[model samples]
Target: MPADDGERGAAALAQMRAMTADICDVIPLTAEDDFRITTATMMIGNALLVDSRVTDLEYDRTPAHIARGGLDHFHVTLCIEGEMWFSSGRRDVMVRAGDICLLDMGPPNRTVLRGGGGRTHLRAIILQRAMLAPRLAHPDAATAILLPAQHPHARLLANHFAALMLPPAPEAGSAEVTIEAIADIAAAAAGGTADIAAGVERAERHLYLAVIKRRIADNLETDALTVDELCRHFQISRATLYRLFETDGGLAHYVREQRLNLAFRQLISPAARETRLIDMAVNMRFSSDSTFIRAFRRKFGLTPGELRELADRWLRETGAVPAIDTVLHQLARRRKS
Candidate 1:
């Protein structure tokens, strides 16, 4: 949840800039004499909502920010009581009160928020790229798509956000459902959804996929990680399981990839550096040490042993361990390119 910065003038402006420096660059366009910012934030998992009333400012996600590698997310902003100009790629948009706009954080973009008098009310939701990209037919096509308040879906979405933000906030148990509802409405409003029902189903698919992924990670050492067994355990049909992992190629491939990832983490972790490859293979459910080595080499272009040694040298020289997820995400992006 967002907390109050509890400062004013130059102090508040500096605080606001620092708050968002990691994700985007914020430039205060308001005068320093009376610069002001207030916000309440709510987040569940990777779904984040910021209800902000702030002074005029320019928010920029530049090429440098993209290269720094944390832009795998999306933003849907509702202009409750403000005027703004937004641009990304070839499109530009003017957003006013009762209007909504979409921003793909993965791309370089700029938005100027003009509060008319150095104060504006805007609600923005940030979501992971993995969560929203699957729902977009052409992810880049809808950037800066404005959904006016008159649009039926936009009106309904506004109501949902308003209700969730009202007194007596929603419970933690309902966070997944809340995120699902928001995603469905925003995707539909952006013209990326086929229908309301399909949008709802797509959102639900991600919710369930997250749960299943957690289970997979928790039970990585189990023999029941196979497709058939997982289907049985989750009480889902084979086709359902396949569809859930369609983007990942297939259920079997997803599991194998996860196992390999987990194995890599184990090999490079200082605590597990002494763990033998054969034991790690068995723990990761590989049939044999040789099988694990070959698969690992094929996927990462390095044998497990070689990768471990490199990780050690890198840590020794830099005094910092390699972050496997960041490396893997970068590697994945490179392959796609």
Candidate 2:
């Protein structure tokens, strides 16, 4: 804390960001007059103990941040007073007072703190992955595991961090012992939570993606295949669905790619030689025939008509129908030539 009153908040913010540099990038979400933060950080070996209070702020962490920081530790945090909302790539968590949250610092995540104004107190013990990974049952699925306030293992761990946060710190030897005990209790509590919260979530995430994708592939003829419909049908938030296909650009992009691929296959089929272009567009969910032709040309280097004619010529010349994929491959080679 700075001796001058004017430097207090600014100094605190800078110090807090520097103290937790290994975790995430902290950005104050409130106005300067409304923003406030205070923190006490203690380091022992490769572990860190932090007690902090903030009015409101966002914790933004990404895979790139982890790579730059080079120390992605696991944080066992106890929300002593206030609330926290967290969303990692795969899980969303809401933590209330007395709840213990096990946050895997490895992945990309966003967290918002709410205390109604500087009343949110979070006491956390940060342990290096090397120190805790061996003890975890499912280390890969550990982020956003919220253990309720009354959970036995959670209560036990919470009580310890509470005592450690008080004045008159424990002796060096006692602190070392404390770290060992915290690690054991945390791994057990977190491992169990991960099994229920994260393990199933991991499998469920894959299942959800598969189900949503299959739905899109099968329903290209209807306008009901939009994101809004998918969300309502699956009873999932848009955020959850978007995260599922983030790497594929987005839900709309994935849908377009699937539609184009399906159209390509249908165009090459022997029975579809006489299919009308407008019908093909309507069946594939494009807004119009022109829209479908432009997109198909952009993606496959040939319009639907051009592709169909070429396929017909190839079949007539060879006296055999080429595989759908082989036709696409031939077009790609032609494009490069």
lDDT of 2 by residue, 217-238 (tens): 6676788778789887777788
Per-residue lDDT value at 332 in model 1: 74
Off by over 4 Å in 1: 2-6, 167-173, 193-337
lDDT of model 1 at position 166: 47
Clashes of each: 1, 1
Shift of residue 7 alpha carbon in model 1, Å: 2.7
lDDT of each: 0.76, 0.75
Off by over 4 Å in 2: 1-23, 166-173, 192-337
Model 1, clash count?
Answer: 1
Worst 10 residues of 2 by lDDT: 165-174
